[model samples]
Each structure stands twice: as C-alpha cells, then as structure tokens.
Target: MQTYNAPLRDMRFVLHELHGLDALTSLPYFADLNAETVDLVLEEASRIATEVLLPLNASGDAEGCIVENGVVRTPKGFREAYDVFRDGGWNALAGDPDYGGQGLPESVNKLVEEMICAANLSFGLYPGLTHGAVMALSAYGSSELKDLYLPKMIDGIWSGAMCLTESQCGTDLGLLRTRAVPQEDGSYLLTGSKIFISAGEHDLTENIIHLVLARLPDAPPGIKGISLFLAPKFLPKPDGSVGPRNGILCTGLEHKMGLKASATCQISFDDAQAWLVGAPHKGMQSMFVMMNEERLGVGIQGLGVASAAYQSAVSYAKDRLQGRSLSGTKRPDLAADPIIVHPDVRRMLMTMRTTAEGCRAVGIWVAQAVDLSKHANTEGERKEAADFVALMTPVVKALFTDLGFEAASLGVQVYGGHGYIREHGVEQYVRDARIAMLYEGTNGIQALDLVGRKMPAHMGRYLRRLFHPISNFIEAHRKHEAVAGMVEQLERAFGALQLATGQIAQAGLKDPEEAGAAATDYLRLLGLVAMGYMFVRSAVIASERLAGNTDEPEFYRAKLASARFFIDRTLPQATALFLAIKSGKASMMALEEAAF
Candidate 1:
C-alpha cells in the first residue's frame, strides 16, 4: 500500500559486513557502540522514518515555508514531526554527550541521517542545522557561550542558524559587504543582510542561535577582514532565560523549486548584538567548521534523496505490469508481467541500487574517518584521518551530489509518465537533489579547491594520506577474479590523480589556468574511483559474509550483487575520465578569448 522507504538492509550490510562494527568498540571512544546497540538504534530510526517523516514529505513540498511579521512557519506537519524527532533524541544522536548529545560515533549517526533524509528531507533540515549549530559551538564557543546555548540546542528547545551569504557573494566570501561593530560590553553590533540562510529563522524551537559572519569597521579588505559572531534570536539573560527579541530578523524567504518546506531566509540585522565566535579575522575558519560539516551533510542529502527516489521507483516497476518479460513471464493469468521482468527496468533499478549503496559505503567510511580524526590519541593518526576528510570532502560534496541528481533523473525515467506527475513525488527528488550541488560551495568551487588547495595541501600530505587506504584496498583485492576489473579501473584513476597532481604542480608553477581546467572533472573521476574501491570492498564483505554462518543470507547476497553491478557497470566510467585527465587541458585552453 505505502511506498518502500529507507534502505535499511543495505545500511546494515555496510555497517556490519563491509566494516567491523563489533571490533570498533575496542577503541575507547567507541567502546559503547557495539553491534547490538547499532542494530537497535537503526531499527528504531527506520520506524520513525517510515511512520512519522515519510507521511509529511509531499505535504511539505506542496505547502512550503511561510513567513509573516518576521516569524517563519514550516509546512503543515513539520513542527509536530520535529517535536517528535527532538523528543526522541534524534538531533543529538551524533552530537557531543557533554552537551546532552547521545555522543555516538559518526558511523552510528550517519545511518540515522540517511533514514531521516530519505523520509522527509525538509523535516530533517531543522534539526540538521541544529546539529551543525551545536557542532560549531562545541568546537569553538567560549564556556560562557557554550554553557548558555548548547543545552537548549541539544534539548531541541532551540535551533541554530548560520548567516554567511550576501546578495553579491555565494561562494566568494572575499566579496561580502556585511559589517559588525564592537561594543564596550564585550559584544559586537552586527548589521548585515544575508541570503539563502537555511533554518535562518524558524518557530520549531524557543530560540534560534545564529553564527553570523560580518566584517568589522577596521576589518581588512576581502575575506581576511571578516569575523564570526554568536548572535541568537533571543538574547540570553544572565540566568540563561530568553529575553526580548534581538535585532536579527528574517526579512524574506526564497521561493525555491524544491525543499520548499525547509525555510531559506533573507535576514537583515540592524546592529544586532553579537559576540565573537573565534579569533578575529578567523571568521571563515569558524563558519567553515559548520560548512564542512554541512557539505558532508549535503552529500548525505544527495544520498538520502537518491535512496528515496530509488526505493519508490523499485516498487513502481514491480507493480506496474505494463510490459512483458524478456524471458517471457509465466503470469498467464495477468494482462502483463511486472515491468521489473524487463531488462531495461532491471537496469534502472540496478543503477539506482548501485549508486545509492556505493554512496552509502563511501559516506560511512568518510564518517568513520571524521570520528577517528576527532578521537584518535596521536597527532599523526589524527592528521591521517583529517587529511582523508580534506581530500574527500569536496569529492563527496561534488561527485556524490552529481550522481545523486543523475540517480534522481534516472529514477523518474523508470516510472515513465507517472513519475513526471506531481502525485508520485519522483520529480521532487530531482528538485531536491539539484540544490545540493549548488549550495555550500558549488561543484565548480569544490573542484578548484581540490586541485588548487586540497591536492597541494601541506605539500602533498593530503593526497599521500588519501592514497594510503585506497592503495591498500587495491593491493589486497588486486587478485580477486570477480572484482579485479574494478580494482584495475580504480588503479588507473588513482594513478591519474597522481599524474594530474604532478602535472598541476608543474603547470600551476607556470600558469594557474591549467590547474583550473583539470579540476571539476578530475574531482568526478576521483569520486568515481573512490566509489569503485568501495564497490570492491562491498563485494569482499558480501562474499565473506555469505561464506560464513548468517541469518540474513538474502540481504548479504543482494549487497554482493549490488557491489558486482556497481563494479561491472559503473566503474568503467573512470576509464573515460582517466583518458581525459591524462590528456591535460590543451583543448580546453585552445579556445580564443573572443570565441564565446
């Protein structure tokens, strides 16, 4: 009757089979996250996703966010759903325990993130911002600020917002014109206009904590002049009670094509009382504290939307008996066999499955990398993990989202005419997936950052660290007959990254355009190869699990099948990218200045 929701089977496979969930608890920080606990947590999350959130998704799209007299209203059932969500401790599931969070490992949190987003992406945005807000404060806020805000935020009584954009600047912070002035009371007066602020202002919580970015009067030109501030919707009194409204107010809302239920705000502050978040002129660093986390979260959004579309399409294909089977269906009693019996239908479903499952594995690995980076005892170990995050963050954001949109489009194609209609909700997925690529630094900027900044960070330390695990995977799996083709493709792509790096290092020294031209597509290639390795890993896990005693045989088998589909069907694209990256910028740069 209802549409299928949340890829729980694949998620569990990634958690237990592809990775050693039971063994990870030996690490002190993760000692509490045993396999049983993980199962319990994920199972409950699945229920909420199917019951509470999924029902509200379409209505949220139809209603969108509403703004009146500086107060914002979420679509029909969002507040109630968010209240249930917060009461269930879902917002703080991946947060710091000292601030009232569950303090689970990033591995545990990502599963919850996937389910919630797949259910109602807009409903999740409210807490999603809160999670980032709490993370920012936990990482950089002073004791007074943390003491005053994180509890209420953690409790879901308050939400968090980050204001960093202006009319002239989206990704280029150097061009922003917002201003903040210091006061004698150890606070700053922030006056600026910020656009596209997600969860910028909402009624889901009693108060909203805004981490605002503005340039001070003495601030230097461009981004170096900027500063970060902790400005809340309601100024906190000495006793931590909400006071009268602060100067910060929502001026308007963006009427976007999708995720309409999640309020995107245009807020203007006329000398709002704001406190410095981190060191002066280090505002970009603090906001990035949230942005990097949000970037990964946006990638999760991509995965989430893809899963939603894919699940619905799978169900639709099975039930819509519009076509005959290639093998000739035996359903003589029916007018036609299920569309899924057709090869074309299988291709669509398999495409969605492989992309979604592969992305899930990559996201899980990246999340673990972040957790280890935070909790690892040694500086060198921490650096290794941080470097992985650095190299992968942009790739995760750009490539995953790109694939996400593509998957969404393919999902619509699966449903044919019914998918294009508003009632089926496939088009909403396409609309939702589109923004992920645009926000939190466009894919173009992500590519440039990869080539210009990430590739060369710390004199190649990031790339070196990134290649370690990838190289290990290739070396270990190089001989496997089933996935050797996949590994060979990955090796070529990995080698291309190395080759491109050397070329960029040489070319960047002479001219920057060569590096820029190679970036975006290079990131895609890198992402594809990285995911190809994940597919190989999944195949290993599935093969190993199926060999041993297992209660969930079918689940494990499908995972292996999906991994094979990914490797055999998807990984070869890296060959095209490998050829292109090796060719290197000559054709791209050959165009004359006036040719356009």
Candidate 2:
C-alpha cells in the first residue's frame, strides 16, 4: 500500500521557496506559521495518514457501507479513526479558535487536506463535506446559528453534507424542484428531494447539518428564486442539546462506481425546519463564497486521487519485474528486470511525479493566496492575491480532476493486468477519480467559467494576473542558465494563450460555440502553463536549497528533472490546443441538431 502523506519538503519549497510564505508568516494571522511549525503539522498529518486512514482504504472499498434499521454503517475502523482525527485537532486545523479550533493558516490546512485525502479519499469525504458546511455556516449564518453549530462542527463532533443536486438538476439551479416556503420567524419550510448528497447520512457524527438549496414559493423565476437553508438531521436546540430529528430523511443511497465507501444519498426534506443562510435572494452569493474552497476542494480531490494513484503506481513499477533493462539486464539472475529500467516506464513515473509536484506547488500557492487575500495589510496586495486565486480556482478544479482521472487511468496502464484487478487498488482509484470531474461544477462548466465569467472579471486582469508573476519569474531568473529554457517555454505557451484569447474573442462574438467547444481544451492548456510555471519555480527553489549542502540534494535534483520532463512532454499539448482554437468553431458546428 502507498502512503498519502503530504511531501513536506516539496510543500515547503512551494511555499517559502516559491510562493513567499514568509510574507504571510510575518502577518498577525499567520505569525506562528514558520517552516518549522508547518513541518511539524505535516509530520503529524503524515502520521495520521500512515496510521489511521490508509488501512481502511481497501477494506472500505470491499466492505463498502450497508444501510439497515435507518442507519448507515461505515466500514470497520472508520469511527475509531475519525475519533483520532478529531482528538488530534486535525479537523480544525484552519478553523477559527473561538470554537475550540486550532486556528492555523489555511495554507497548512490545505497540505493536511492533501495528505488526508490521499490516504483514503473515500473516508476523507465525510469530514471534507463537514468542513464545507462549517465554512458556509460560519461565513453566512447568523450568530444564533453559529453558536448552535460551529463548536460541534469545528470540534469534529458533528459532520455535514451539501444538498444541491436533484434528479432533474445538477448545476442548473433554475431547473431544481426543491422548494422552501418562508416561515413567519424568517426560517423556511424546506420540502424536496436532493440526490448525489455525499456524506448525507452516516454514523461518523452525532448530527448531520445539511446546507440545502431550494426555490421559494413566491420567489422570482429561475435562479433568482433559489435560496440556501440549514436543515440538520436533528435541529440544535437553544441549550445546545440536540432537538428532535428534523423532517429530513435519507431516502436511499446512490450505488456509485467510485467513492463507494462515501455514501451518496438521496435525501428527502418534508417541510423541514430550515434556517436561512444569508438573505434569500442573495443565497447564490453566499454559495459562491464557499465555492472557491469547494471548487479548490474538488481540485484537492484531484490532487488526492492523483497522488495516491501516482504514489501507488510508482511503488508497483519498482517492485514488479516484467522486462529486461534497456541498458541490457544487469539483473540477469532474474528472468526479467524491473519495469523502471525502461525509459518509457521512467517517463510514465516521471509524468505522475511531475504532475503531483506541480499540483502540490500550485495548490499551496493558491492556499497561500487565500490566506494573504484575507490578511494582507495593504489593499493592493490583498486584491492581487485575491485576484490570483479567483482566476486560478476554476482551472485548478477542472484541470486537476481531469488530469487526476487521466493519471489514474495511466497508473492502471502502468500496472498492466494487475492494475485492472480489484485487488491491486489502482482500478478503484480510477473509479473514484471519475466523479471528481463531474462534481464541483463539472469540468465543462469550470472551463466555461474560466473563459467566460472569470476570464473577463477584471477586463483582462486575470490574464495579467497570471502574466505579472510569469514576467517576474522570467526577469528574476533570466540569468540562471539551468532554467532559462524552461522560462522560454513558458513564454511560448503564454504567446499561445494570447493567440487563443484573440481567436476566441473574435469567434465567440460571431459564434459562442467557438469558445464553448474549445473551452475544455483551452482550460487544460492554461492549467498546463500555470502548473508548469509553478513546477519550474519550485525546481529553481529546490536547486537553490540544494546549493546549501543539504542532506537531501537528490530530492531537489529529482524535482528539477521532473520540471524538465513536464516541459519536454506536456507543454507541447498547449500548442496543438492553440491551433485547434484558431481553427475556429466550424468543426464544432459541422452539422446542425439533426445531423447525427
């Protein structure tokens, strides 16, 4: 089995070395978060991943969950493991301190999240959804709601779920049938069925808080009528004791292909006592506040799935002796040499490693941005960091998950026949990763948001937002002999992006599908460039760190080599994407609706 601990050295390199964590560490909010402290956190998280979570991964996959007597039974050891997670304060790493949370920076929390998810993504979804619910309630709920909920939630005593998808609607809220009738005291009576509600019903927590979205009776038509509500399994009373069970019930669970251990429930809310989250009409705004993390969380879902798949595949490749070495077998005593001896296997392993490194680097940078944007002293600095994260969130979610699924598939390929077998675990990973692309606003929607809403948010500020950092990196490292070619590659990719922008802007005006059809590929290209930049930056930092005569010179060297691998193999895809976008929407519009 593979360990899912965050690569602490790589995380630090991406943070202090590449993304400037020191600047935030000096801030009051992040004052205690230096490299040493951060490493301690990662080390502890690693211990949890190695000790608690990974063990149940295969067990949960095989045993899955069984629902009987109106209760869902988690796989063996999950309840006990969750207890350790709570006892260690892992659940509240970045939570506010007022509610018994440790109040660490989100940057640290993100690293921890990566580790936890990698260890056992199915198990991790329970708390991951809880964290999202907490964020929504903390940010948008009233004081009464916070006092009632935050402590238990932050303490990891109560878990949570998101109720958005229905049979008729997934992303299109306007088409949803979930209904909420306004009550006299400002609460609402929610009645509807929500499907695909992950962690919707479980034994892990005392109470499950559901953040449901529904349409009001006299509400304006479409999404404007949509509202957010807090409908718990059991309403929390004023004295903090659990009230009678609310009107919500778990109708059934979805037998998903992936994340089988994580229950995907179809919930029924029959005039449930629901508290409004934010104002009725502005629920979408409040939802968007959480989407950044949720989407990024989905990105982390990608990171988690990919890291596990890659790490496991790497181990498998090393131990599985299948073929003679390309250099003529030194292992002549054995029938065949390890697969890693071949350049192509080496290439596959390196691709996974490089992608993992890139995603970690970019995710950490995004995490740091989220922290700085919240705490930066100067408005300009705050806005810049905020813009950076906002621009990158959709790309991270779409690209990471898309690539994560692809990487899982590749891992299976690397394992040959064993990979396809359920016993090996790689096939399960592929199944688990498949859903991440569809959820969290779906990759297609994410791509459209990138090219449509987010791209134009600042009138090209987002593109400039990316370019400023690229320019700075280029100027700062132009003289460095090892990295100049990589920078030139990024420059070429950036030019490709520019031409893409021009071509799309022109064609989109004439035919919107021109942008729509190419949006998915275009987003991947941007993610490649963006992740490539982070990889190169990380490599540069790792090299500089190596110059200090460290005990781990090879680790840094490996990272630099991985960066080179991405440049050689991956960035060229962007060029093809650029030409495809330039080819216009004609291919996409080859025939009208009846052509098929």
Candidate 3:
C-alpha cells in the first residue's frame, strides 16, 4: 500500500494566505480561533489521517465487507480505526456545540475531510454519512428527535446513513415507491427499500441512524407526497438507549468496482418505526440538507483520491527508470533517465499538480463562503455569502470530480502498465473516482442544476455574486505588470464564460433541450474560468510574496509557474466549451429513439 501524507504546506497556504484565516477571527463565532490554533488542529488531523487511517486502506479494500447471518461485518481494522476516530472527538470537529460538538467553521472541517478522504475514503464514509445525518436532524428534525439522536451521532457512538436511492429510482425521487403509514403512537411505520446506501450497515458503530424518504398513504402523487423520516436500526427506548431491533434490515451489500470496503447496502424497512422529520410532503427539502452537504463532501472525495493518485504518479516518475530526455541523457551514469526528465511526463505532472492545487483553492474558497453564509454578522453579508454558495456549489461538485477523474487517469498514464495493475493502487483511484461523478446527483445533474436553476435563481443574483468579484478583480489588477499576463488570460476566459452563459440561457428560453444539451459544456466553461479566477488570485499573491522577499522563494515561484500553466494551457479550454455550447441542440436531438 502507498503511504499517504497530507499536503500540510499547501493546505496552510490556502487557509492562511489565500483565504485569510486570520480575518475569520473577526466573526463572533470564530473569535477564539487564531492562525496557530488552526495550524495545531490541522497538524493533529494530518497525524491521525496518515497514521491511523491510511494503513487500513489497502487491507480493507482487499478484504472488503461481508455478511454473516444477516449481520454486515467490515474488514478487519476498520472497527478499531473507527473506535479511535470516535474517541478522538474527530466526529464532532464541526458539529453543533450545543450537542457535544467543537463548533468549528465548515472550512476547517472541509480541509480536514480532504485529509481523511485522501488517507482512507472507505473509512471516511462512515463519519461522512454521520455528519450528513447530523446536519439533517439538526436543521429539520423536531426537538425531541434532536435530543434523542444528535448526542449519540455527534459523539460518533452511532453512525448515520441517508436512505434516498431505490432500485427503480436513482435521481428521480418522484417515482419512488417507499410508503409510510401513520401510527396511533405518533410514530410512522415505514415500508421501503433503499439501494446504494453508503455506511448503511456496519460494525464500526453501536447503532445506525437512517434518514429515510417515504410517502404517506393519503398523500398526493409525485414528489409532493414524499416525506423524510428518522429511523434507526434499533428503536431507541424511553430513556434514549438502544432497544429491540426495528423492522430495518440489510438485505445485501453490493459488489462494487472500488471503495469496496465501504458498505453499499440494499436496505429494507418493513413496517419500521420512524418519526417524521421536517414538514410532511417536504422530504426533498429536508433531504437537501444532507444532499448538499454530501455533494460537497463527494467532490472532496474526488480531490482526495486524485491527490493520492498524483502523489503516487509523482513518486513513480521520479524513481522509475525509463526513456532518456529528448534533448540528451539526463543521467549519464544510468542506462536511462527517470521519466520525470521527459517533457511529456513533466506536462502530465504539472497538469495533475495544477489541477489539484487549483481545485483546492476554489474548494476552500467555497467553504469559506459556506462559513460566511451561516455565521456572518449581518443579513446582507449572509445573503451575499449564500448567493455565492448557491451559484458555485454545483460548479464545485461537477468540476472538481470531473477533473479528479482526469487526474487519476493521468496517474495511470504516467505509470504505464504498473498503474493498471492492482499492486500499484492508481487503478483503484480511477475506479473509486468513477463513482464520484455518478453519485451525489451526478455530474450531469450538477451541470443541469448550474445552468437551469442556479443561473436564473432570484433573477441571476447568484451568478452576479460570483461574476462581480472576478470582474472587479480583473478591472482592479489588469494594469499591474506583475500579474498582467494572468489577468489578461483570466479576463478572456471570464468573457467566454459570460458569453456562454448568455447564449445558453437564450437558447434554453427558446428550447429547453438546448439547455440540457449545452449544460455540461457550459458547466465546464464555468469551471475553467472559475479555476482561472483562482489562479489569477494565486498569481497575484505569489507576486506579492516574491516582491516581499519571502523566505520560501521556491514555493512562491512554483505557485506562479502552476498559475501560468493553468492560464496558458487550461483556461483556453473555456473557449472550446463556449463554442460547443453555441452549437445548440439540433445535432444532439437529431438522433432517434431507435438509433441506440
């Protein structure tokens, strides 16, 4: 197994320099936080991630989970690792302070999650799901429900699962068949099956909390009839302790292509005891609490896996002896030079590194936005922050995962045959990353949401929240010689994004299918431009650091190089995406139903 190390320097740079962690201390909620405290927390998180979680990754993947007598048993070491994780208070790092949580900012949690995911994605899933459940219950559940469940879940003694998917329905929840009948005791009896449930049934926790979606008997048809329910594998007693087993059962675990150690279960609720969460017939809204959280978390999964892949690729490239440098022998003493000496290999490595760093920049930026949305002092500040969150969430989800898959593939390409083999682990990254683009509402769905809903939300308010900053930045710094090149490149890409946005919106106004056909390309356009925006920001900061005669000249210089590569090589892709969107829907719709 390849050992994992958290990118502490880069992470620190992002938090303290790029996002201005010190500025957050002004917020009342974060008044106690300082740079040193954040650093210590990050170092501790890195230690646990690299030491406790990474060692179990390969073994867990190889061994996987198994079911015996209807009980799902995780691979060896998972249970113990999870115990350590829970005991460390890692589960409550960002939970509500009122419910035994540390009450930290989401940005800190987001960064920590990236480390956890990079170390062991499967192990991270258990806590990841629990966090999502905690969010849902905290936001929408009744007071009694929160009191009964939040403590254990926040404490990590009990894990959580979001039960949404059914075999017949994946993204279309309106067609779901799950039903709930109201009981005289005020609790509902849930009857349904949920498929592809991550951390659904595991031995790592004392209890499993399931946030299920079901429909009431007298409810109207379609999505309006659906309701969210809080159901546990074991019903809680009057004293809030685990009681007899409820009507919930894990029917089976799916044999997946990757992350095999994470139990993706087929769960059945046969007249299970459940309490309604949120208002009736508003399950979708209730579930969005978890869905949105998971969407961002899933994007981090992409980053984590890709980071692992990139590290492996870099390691292999530096050590593996292969072709000589095109110019001449890089190492005369050796038969052939390391692959890192090759220009093409350098290009791939630069692409992987730039993508990871670029995505991290935007991901953390959005995370800060999340923090502001929830805790900003003024309503106006909160609204502006929320607008950015609304506009960029989909972009973050789709773009990061899409680029993540590409980076993972590049890792395999860098390694040649060795990467494809099981022993190398890069192949597992590719396999694991494949699902990220598919789940959490899929990349396509994210794109559609971006173009169809987010763009026009509140009359383009969200888009303006994002676009105004880039425009102001470009206008403010376009004349500066140090960052003129990056500013120019970013300006052009931003223009292309603006043009594509208007064109796609107009086309969609005429024919909705035009929007659907163009959604993916439009999203790609936005993503590239967004990354370009961050790269420009990074270039400006790097230039400032260089001008200040920073101690780490090499690090700042490398940041500039990465920004240049992204602006010169990657940002131009937005123009291509813009052209694709301009092509409209005729060609895409020409194919007949029988063509396939």
Best by TM-score: 3
Clash count in backbone of candidate 3: 0
Best by lDDT: 3
Between candidates 2 and 3, the lDDT winner? 3
TM-score for candidate 1: 0.96
Instruction: Please give, for residues 1-596, the per-residue lDDT of candidate 1 as tens digits.
Output: 12646676678777777766754576777777778888889999999999999998888899888899999998887788888888998887877788787888887787788888888888778888888878887888899889888888988899988888899987788898888888999999988899999999887888999998888888889889888899889988888889989998898999998999899999999888999988899888888888898888888888888888888888888788885767777577899997888888888889988888888988988888888788877888888889899889998888888988998998889889888898888888989889899988999999999988988888888887667888998898899866677677678767876676676788777878877877886898778777877887877776776788988789778877876787677776766765676677789888899997
**How close is every model to the real structure, measured as TM-score?**
0.96, 0.97, 0.99
Ranking by TM-score: 3, 2, 1
lDDT of 2 at 302: 85
Q: Pairing residues by index, what is the TM-score of model 2?
A: 0.97
Query: How much RMSD separates candidate 2 from the native structure?
Result: 1.6
Candidates' C-alpha lDDT: 0.83, 0.83, 0.90
Q: Deviation in angstroms for 85 in model 3?
A: 1.0
lDDT of 2: 0.83
**Shift in Å, residue 66, candidate 2:** 2.1
